[model samples]
Target: MKQRYHVLLCLLGVIGCLLFFPRDLSSALTFTPQALYDLTASRTGQAAAKPVPFVSSGFAGFLDENGRPQYVEKIRYGAAVSSMGIINYDSVSTKLVMRNRDGEIQVAIETRGYPFFLKERLLIISTDRLRLKEYTTDGDLLWSATFPSPVTACAAAGNRFLIGLLNGNFLYLNEAGEPLYSFTPPEGRIKVAYGAAMDAASEASLVVAGIDPQTAYLLEERNGELNSIESFPLGSDLRRNLLVSSLHGGRFAIEQEQGLLVVDRTNLRRRYFSIPGRLLSVQGHPESNLLSALSQDDSDRFVSMIGSESNYRGRLRLAGYGPGTSILWSGNRFIILVDGHVLVYRLELI
Candidate 1:
């Protein structure tokens, strides 16, 4: 039943791109779309930033800016591809294959775990879920830690990372893997933590915990101590985990029922924006107060840009196929991955 739920949540295929190019730029430049593979048979995956990462059933790799595959490899257990490189683990050999941007084998490490990227660092959660290892992008181990209970959720920013365990313990750790502070949300029927997010500035952190009645808490760090500034009740059931992110301008956003609750941490002001479908991915611009979200309901998909005060700026209708889709905003570039294909757009405002 758990595997069935995973499959149901993963099969969101995108078929076309959002033509967001302005009229003037459309005449001066041409935007081309590329299909890297046929992912109709593929089950679950996601996309990352530049040299975008694409993963299907048994294959994984990264694509260059032009939507061309830089490297592609077959895998068995798990794979984590970032703008930095690729980390693939083969259970049979009990080894990890690390590759560079150009698909060159840089190094190989022996480990049995699921490799993933946390912010700019590489981390692997042990198969037993009791241990965590952080490694540099080059496949060198930086630090590792053991937890008394299973790690249920994690998030990272700037130089700090937060890890939440099944026992309701949340540990805030610095770059050296040293714990700075620990917290546990007060009162809950079930203690499991579902998700967490922290901004790059380390000013605020968000966590959603419990089962029967999940709750979202916004926390502030001051004088080396973490304090809960606000708390909100969340829906009892969720198809996807909470979409919690620390946005620009001292603001944070949380995915509520059918809209997003945007709050300013400094003044405790709030705004809400209603999204049309199942929210897939959200990316916030670091330099500006621009927020982009991707959503899909059945065969209809959309990419919307939001400004301050939950103001709707613009939206583009996207068409696509398969079982998964995601969006990433880096500077003025908007990247969308549908099924197994990658589409990148360079936006210029007039």
Candidate 2:
């Protein structure tokens, strides 16, 4: 009788404890509603500072971190979206105006060609696209370079910039627009560099160049010199500029066909993830393994949250197809414009 009473008491205690302290059901990756606004509404003005740049509904503007409209204006020619700010061009005056998120004008340059921002530097491409000039953020002309072949692609990180030429050559330039290293991939039948990316990190800065005929070259900058580390053969032809990004876990991602080819930096082992439909853009968390991708599979458009370790998190469906749909991801917030509604979703813990 004593033993039976003791066993019953222990079982009852366990049940009571479980009932009182429940297990945490929080998810590692989830989304919460942050803010939403209708871009169709008449919300126009020069907004406050510290907002993300977006283009929608023939309007270019800045949105706060909370996804609220800061500054909205009717675009004339076109607008270039950058992490720092935006470059709005005036076709009539042939002037390019650069503005920061704080609604402050950084520089205004009058050029016949279109001007785009590469980090803090402004690049003005000639009307024929054969000549390129680099300028400071204050609109001072630094240096000009004319290429015999067409410039296929370009990327900038911090003080460094990479330019890929159609002749299969790639050039790495320093902060003063001086060439640091230049190389051409030998094995490619078509000597063309499709894309290039540089690391913004001060330590162990890496340079990635994607060449035509499906090859990616990796270079590391150390002790003021660049050394070729490794090369990977991508099976598909990169028709457009390569979307290569160095991730958190010593890995990098290259957009190929209907998926992303994620390669390990150490062993050069490759893992492919099918992102469904055509991959538009990829945004990754700097400290974590999370990557967000925007894709338009046929007429259905959505944003997929993916793990760098080949794990599928979830996806959020956006408005249907057309020029009206656009999405941008920054920090933990996702700003999406579907049709005319602008919806913002923040990464949640629950």
Best by TM-score: 2
Which of the numbered candidates is closest to the native, going by highest lDDT? 1
Reference-based TM-score of each model: 0.77, 0.81
Model 2, poorest ten-residue lDDT window?
Answer: 202-211
Off by over 4 Å in 1: 1-60, 63-69, 72-77, 90-93, 235-240
Q: In each prediction, how many residue pairs overlap at the backbone (N, C-alpha, C within less than 3 A)?
A: 12, 3
Q: Write the per-residue lDDT of candidate 1 for residues 1-350, one digit (tens) a residue.
A: 69544433443222232233342322333223323333333323333246666664356776555455556766556678777778777654467777876667877777778888877588888988899998875668889988889988889988898998888778998898888998887757778777788876887888887765678778879897799999877653463457777776777777766567777888877788888776666678666777788776777788777765746776767554434566765455566665454556665544
Considering summed lDDT, which 10 consecutive residues are worst modelled in model 1? 12-21
Candidate 2 lDDT tens digits, 178-211: 8887877766666767766665652223333344
Q: Rate the local accuracy (lDDT) of all candidates.
A: 0.69, 0.68
